[model samples]
Target chain A: MIEVAGGRLIAELTVRRPSFTLDVSLEVAAGELVAVLGPNGSGKSTLLGALAGLLRPDTGRIELDGRVLTDTTAGVHVPAHRRRVSLLAQQALLFPHLSVAANVAFGPRCAGVGRAAANEQARGWLAEVDALELARRRPGQLSGGQAQRVALARALAGEPELLLLDEPLASLDIDVAPAMRSLLRRVLRGDRGGGDRGGNAVGARTALLVTHHLLDAVVLANRVVVLAEGRVVEDGPAREVLTRPRSPFAARIAGLNLIPGTGCAEGLRTHDGTLVSGLLDAGVSGLLDAGESDSWDGAPAVAVFAPSAVSVFRQRPDGSPRNVFAVRLAALEPHAEVVRLRVSAPPGGPDWLDGLAADISPAAVADLGIGDALGDVLWFAVKATEVLAHPSVH
Target chain B: MVGVGLPVVLWAPAVLGFALVALPVVGLVLRADLVRLPELMTSEEALTALKLSLFTAAVSTLLTALLGGPLAAVLARSRSAAVRLARPVVLLPLVLPPVVGGLALLYTLGRTGPGGRLLELWFGVTVPFTTAAVVLAQTFVSMPFLVVSLEGALRTAGERYERVAATLGAAPATVFRRVTLPLVLPGLGSGLVLAFARSLGEFGATVAFAGSLEGTTRTLPLLVYQQREVDTDGAIALSLVLVVVAVVVVAVARPRVAEGAQ
Candidate 1:
């Protein structure tokens, strides 16, 4: 039998909720799992709701694989069930009365699959999620993780062309999250744990995952789309966008330092008139596309780099090694395995420089005994080759 | 903690309030002619009233289910302020005196009111003084119980599961039949029982609108009320039976609380 291949999803829709509004236009290739990462109320769920046809967009079109799922002007709109798109909500709302297996079978049964056949298909999905052992139990008897597994199995049993996940792991315990994420990866990759790739019932699924966890994008998605205040602030390859973010939100989530500046004829200059002397053209090229040196004639650019590349010193070093600047200590926050110091920009700095984070080892923090007594200032410098400057989209 | 052991003063009224509900039924049972109960209950008038009561109440319950289901669902899901604001109007019959309810139905469907005239002009049908009028009167007084119960259940159940079911390839009808209906079945069951019990004991509206005929509208409650004029003993016996029926209905519809919200 010939498979009627699923096509890419292209949406240029504006969803206007009473409290929020999301306007985005993008396309996702078939079989690509794109992670939509944003903070709470940033229209991440709104995007998923519109795509799943749960909430109709106030305007614009949503075409999935050339099929017009929503087109306001053309007056074509498909409701949820007919749209062939499935959504896995943040909460695992399994049917309380139905057994785990029956909940899984519900989707197929709705498609007019016979009772026995639907039950058989349900068992297959249950086995895939490793919840076959708990198939006979009702939702009330299952743990949160088990119920989520059944919910996921139920969603896939319908064989949707597009699958939307709204923080599938947000409700799980922190310790149980890793297992669920990995399960999501395996199912999304269509490789059931035995390296049996073709065994997935939902073949080559197109999925959009809304998440706040960077780990979800790092592990499960090949691309990332970040939103802020109901706007698409950034979208690019997962690592590039995360590592070299143009916006502060992405930089914070990716744990990177972004220095805002403008690209001029001579070189890149910080907004506060700090001529960052060390960064080389070669290093900044990696953050931008090929025509960086020529293209960025005069544009708002930001220097992006990992916090580890910054060297902190108690006093002004004897020699200006590469680039040197003094930053006033604002506050201290503990990050994983390291101490992150929030540093205020040298006085009279631009708005973006108000909060700059630098990470140093705990031993260094204690040895320096950095506190209000030490004037709460640290002299930090970065090597020339480590400074990466990219144009800030905002 | 401060109020914990206040006194017998505080506890006496609270305890009495609890006992007050069962004491009256207990008194009726004690005064009933149990020795002659079998003979008294199976008399011609008693049997006619009991059979008519059961048949009319059953039909009324069925009507409540058919009409009240969609009304409850819409009230549960609609966002219109007008629909919400109409709750008191729908519930008026429940709170109104049964005699007032009978009078309202009588005026609206009698011989000259707009509703009555419309039906009369359209189908030459006179609503009052018929067996069908008995069912209609019973429905007017009892349907609000079903609507209120089912509406609470549907509101608590909410649209979450229905939305999930829709995304999972279930059409609108299928979602209602397969997911929505089963989720609210317990509520529906209890509501039906409440409506049935209400209809079985319906007295004021039947007497006022349908009128208490021998084999037409004289339900069990009517029989008990009339037996007091002739045989007070039989009236106590019939009253005791209605009490038993009420108890059975309550026992059958015992709340299955705390089953799934965990």
Candidate 2:
């Protein structure tokens, strides 16, 4: 098995260029796809560059399967070509002069396969991408999606142990994204799942998919690692992380309300004292209990939930969930299928109301006619299980 | 009327300037007697000079490419101190007058010169007054043209493609052979043509270093100069032949450069 086994990708890599410093530590196991999600200048690309051996990490170690790719301590450093890691940048930089077949054959040829053998292998890869018909065509003659597919084939042909994708679909037009995503999912599955021709070694390929698109991560990656200001704010299973984000950044990506708060057995309390009662999820309950002790360092924390999770009624609905709170409709904003209502919870009751934002559907707003009111107390009930506690505000 | 006249007036001088520069070549072709061409081809000295010119130019072009191609690649790829120093030194020969280049070669390879002394001491051989000296002089003058052209091509071709090649598992040498060489071929081809043409017409260096020895050091240009001292018509005929060869070389090499640019 290609086990990563607790190896730390620790880097205090400070490239101070009169603007910013990028410092982060990350770890991943073999057979896992970690999606590095962030906005621009969030050190997502910088971190990938450092990991890929393109940029030298100013300090720290990058290990893969216990093999040191870069370690400043031991003076072990491998160049980019020898790293056996494949990178698919946003550009899909296929060589312009070479034919599609020749471009795919490049890696195999470099690996010491004879020209004819390399070409044969390239044809197989092209057929896998369904682009064997375009093998003789130049990169300039292909569409953006076609070029990206060829690039993916070229990278996979090397049979790299570690694959890094930097927003591989970012440059494509929206109409082609779904098709590209489907193709990418198939490739990812083929590489990871041990049920097909691509499945040989247990964890032969570990992937890090860098993307700003949340849906792409949700669909393709096994786990999502949220990066903000050059540090990982949250990392977990994709569904869990996306639905119940632990950071404001993740909350923004997942379109949920993320507030910094503390918790007790009764519920979570915002720093401004808006008490959210009845957190019954054991995982969340344990976090609440942990926060109630003297040993509890009042470290910065986050409370997150989806907009749909918080039900808004015109008046107090009888037998509603215990975590109900009275809130004034602060602002209304129209999102895709829903109108996100900014509910202002009363201050000093529990600090859970601090910087709290919630999304309510257009149907809920129409049903209640809760429009442009400043001080109307709208009853809002959230299920206890939906209230998630994460350790940082992000 | 004045506005229309102004642009036409402004462009007239440039048009005339181009015509002035092209006049000599047009004059050469126009003045040549088509009937005398067949008789000129039959002359023994003319044929010997043409053959010797072709031979020396081919040898010179081959040597230039062999030596300059690697030198250009090194200058293109390396950031070492020696390479930094050697690049400008390579261009020094290119900028020097052909006669000055000839004098420099003469000083280094003349009978009593340092290289000549070594040759005599080691192998009991001398290169001056020989066809080999003519080839050597022509190569010395023309090699810088190939190096400079190929160097520019290499620089523009960039290291990204080579790095990609390497990552694909190509050893450094294979990347050079497959990717780097083919990309620079157009520039290399044009450089070879220019070097060949320059060698064919090389007179100053050959005369200074190899001396005016008939059938040996007498390249086409040297033969033309020698014939001019006695028979001016023979000189004109040889000049016509050189011009035709140069035109054909330019005709072939220009399209290659244009295609590469595209």
Candidate 3:
């Protein structure tokens, strides 16, 4: 039996649909803002649905703050309203017919709070979100950011055990995101609340934010769980994962190149059996802390580094770097300030090392005489200090 | 707009149909005994029928809303095949001839039908030829209007807001009361007015199922029909009252601005 943590949420859920199957397991510790990051159709919304009780999982268990919200095995299920969870979606979803004050008061009112007390609580939350002035206004009249502020206030007024935010900032204007981001940071950090903000009777005011924007995680979340195709692909401390991603999708979002392999004391041998003999940076070297006996046991690992770390050479001109691979240009496309060359893997590579992309200047392309639809064989190398090798995430 | 001047013969029938609808109302107004309208309407028969009509129609509208609300909500939210089939089936009375609807109501609640026989045998209640029968006939035909209108509004409003409310700690009943009801108020209002008007003008059903009894089941429409044969002046005078009700119905039910474009 798993011991439950107070103010903690643990879910091992498998929700089945005709077109989608979301199977994931995770734990959110007390006061932790965990961002469920994923691209579209990645089951980010589905996970929120299951947690919020809008959609029931076929077989699983979900426990929040040591209380079971759902347990299919035991046939125990709580309704959404009774679970004390609050959800804020991309749209503010403020009740259009209700005034902003009434909208925020709705949750408390439903919880059997007296109307006056509920309105006062609503006012308090609105003030916390800096939306007190909009209390009399209808949702249709409010701007995008203001509506979202009211929505946040409404969700907070519930004193929810778990707060689910699904792309809360996704629909805001570009000019509004920065301010909203900082406001959310303040609220999630418990800065404006009483001394025991997330520690009152309802346990912690824990939150799960589903977002595609990495910046939201960087600014608002303390932990990040990356989802791809409905699976928990990676989970780590927010800054840790953002700065040193170990999974391919996370690496892509972090704008780094990742090569999956098995780590040895020397370095990483990629899936193609090509020895990527790079000196382990401190971050990558952490995975190699084990002795030779443990190291050779063959747990998969990934070597991640920035595109700029790999230098292209006309001929094999690498004297210092041991990792040298011949590559042929597959295609060239424009990146922000540089042209990215998508190339086939090193010559003599196994079928597993499919391809990689490297950023180069237009001047560099011209200097190398790279042509449109170029098929010329080139060589690329990376110094040992650049690669961060870690145990594979997936 | 249709093509300008294709053929006169093709469009003549539509114009003639429009005229046919307009001429009767125009003739009624033209021949209205306006000067003695107050005196004619205050007569014993006219007053009884007017009061009975108002009472039955109001009661029928209330009953329609009370009974139809849950049915509309179910039809709006459920994806089951029976509900899908039954939604339009519930509106049969709306498209049905009122005389036919009245006959159906008569057989179901008359002395011989199983429900009617059981009611009389168990409770000593005879439903037909009574005020209750008038209310029932009006409800049988007009309830469909309320249901269909409310069902459309409920479907348009959708369950997203209700789901959000539920997650916000509001119980299902609370969500319906505070969220769903208020959101569908406009549709409910229109449905009520339409049902009221249908009940008011429910001549065929009232006469056939409830019978034409003065001060009991004979409503305004039945009074006007009786007056039309024996007293033209009284019929026109009573018609003016109906026209007033129709005007009020239009004023109350007409949608303003048509849509929430913003």
Candidate 4:
């Protein structure tokens, strides 16, 4: 069984360049897929390098399967070749000189297996990736998708216990992503042969997949860890973390409207004089409730909900829900299949209502023609189940 | 008009440069003494010099590749201070004059040199003025070209491919042999050809150390030098042979090396 018990990955590395310092700490469980989400200079690639044993952590410990790979405290550092962890970066860097079969066979040969035996094993892996037909072809001959498959087969051929995938589909075109995702799912699940003994399967291998793409995490990862400013801002089940994010970075990635406020039984009182009501928990609401509740007089909080959950109507409806607001359509922008409508409510009622963001389907938007008028009154409603309130220290 | 003219203007110098290079080769072939070519080919001295040149150049190239391939790989992969320190030292022979490099080799392997003293005390053997000394001197001078070229190729080729091989279960050494070495084959091949060509034309180092023996230490270039003092036609014939051998080597190696480089 693939198990990582208390395998802490703590790194305080300081790489001093002309500008910037990469300092990060991380802990991942076996069978968990943590996505190190960040912008370009967010130390994501550097953190992956440190984890892969390509770069040494100035002060930290990296352990896999309860074995100490790197621990500055006890003075132990394992070289990359001995780490037995597979790292597949953005580019499917297959050896151009060797044939696909030979490239796959490379690991087996290096592990001291006989040439014939390594080839036999490599052939099986090639077949698993559905690349057996191109086994004799060099990497330069394969298409982007085909080359990535060969890279996957080569990585899997070694039967490594820990798998590391760094934006494996980043270089692929949009049409190729779904197919590659499925292929990666199959490989990571250990469904194709070697019988789920090690790797990222449920009972087999453990994996750490790093990617900036949120959709990839939703499709492939079971657990999602959102990294912001080189720190774990939010970490939990992929669905919960992606849908209902706690951090602003997570909120941004999941496309949710997050506002800092105080929670109450009636609603959340935002700092900008807006009251958001219909929350689930009274204690959390009471803690953030601002209206004469002495316990939460000077407390901080955050109210968050999906833009999709906040429905916008052109006119005020008779007998509307409690969280309804009459707002002015400040701006309307098209985003893929949906249109993001930014509305501003009348000032002085509640602090946060000054700015309310809402996302509606293109069909709904077109039918309503919300883009026609800017200053027109737009009614918006949010369900209690859709509203989430948490403490906001900032 | 500017777009079309810009390319032509930029390319004219390059085209002219190639024509200038081809001029000397064409002149050499046109001016060759065809009537005496057959007589020169059958001469015992000419045959001995050709054979010795071929044998010594081949042996030296083989030795250079055998030693330089791993050294290049080490230099390419290592980041240690020792490796960094040794890289310039390994390339020293390439930049040094062939005669000076030969002197350095002599001081280390000559009759009264430290290594030579140990060899005499233990086995009573001296290295100077011998065929083996010629091979050693040629290898010493030619090895750095192979190492430098191969090392540069290895650096540009990167370590990602090797890591991919490792993930596929290939061991470190296996990755080098099967993946790393093969990827850099074009550079290595070109380096080998260059080393062989250098060794074939080697004269300063050979004369300084091996002392120009007729059947042993005398290579084609040395033979040409010796013949120039006595017979100008014989020297021209030897020079023609050297040119022909170089052309053959380039013809055979160019396409394959180009393909590998790609």
Give the top-scoring candidate (TM-score).
Answer: 1
Which regions of candidate 1 are displaced past 4 Å? A1-5, A191-203, A265-298, A310-332, A342-355, A370-386, B1-10, B33-38, B256-262
DockQ of 1: 0.73
lDDT of 4 by residue, A217-278 (tens): 88778777766565556667888776666666667677787766665555567665667765
Fnat values, one per model, are 0.90, 0.42, 0.92, 0.62
Between prediction 2 and prediction 3, which has the larger lDDT?
Answer: 3
True contacts kept of 1: 0.90
- In model 3, the Cα lDDT at residue A137 comes to 92
Q: Calculate the i-RMS of every candidate, to one decimal place.
A: 0.8, 2.2, 0.6, 2.3
Alpha-carbon shift of residue B161 in model 4 (angstroms): 1.3
Docking class of 2: acceptable
lDDT (Cα, tens digit) per residue for candidate 3, span A137-238 = 999999999999999889888888788999999999999989888778767655433453332122225889998888898877878998878888789888
lDDT value for model 4? 0.76
Model 4 misplaced regions, further than 4 Å: A1-27, A108-120, A190-204, A259-283, A286-301, A305-333, A336-338, A341-388, A392-394, B1-16, B85-89, B92-95, B104-123
User: lDDT per residue, candidate 3, B1-262, as tens digits?
Assistant: 8766777676889889999988988998889787888999788899899999999999999999889888889888998998889877888998899888888888988999888999999999999999999999999899988888888888888899999999998888899999999888888888888889999999888888988989899999999998898998998889888988998887868872133111
Report the C-alpha lDDT of model 2 over A215-292, residue by residue, as the tens digit. 988888878988777777787898988876777778877877776666544545666666655444455446547775
Off-target runs (Cα >4 Å) in candidate 3 are A1-6, A191-204, A259-300, A310-336, A339-356, A365-387, B1-24, B27-44, B79-82, B226-237, B256-262
Q: How well does candidate 4 score on lDDT at residue A307?
A: 86
RMSD of each: 3.9, 7.1, 5.3, 6.0
Decide which is better by DockQ, 2 or 3: 3
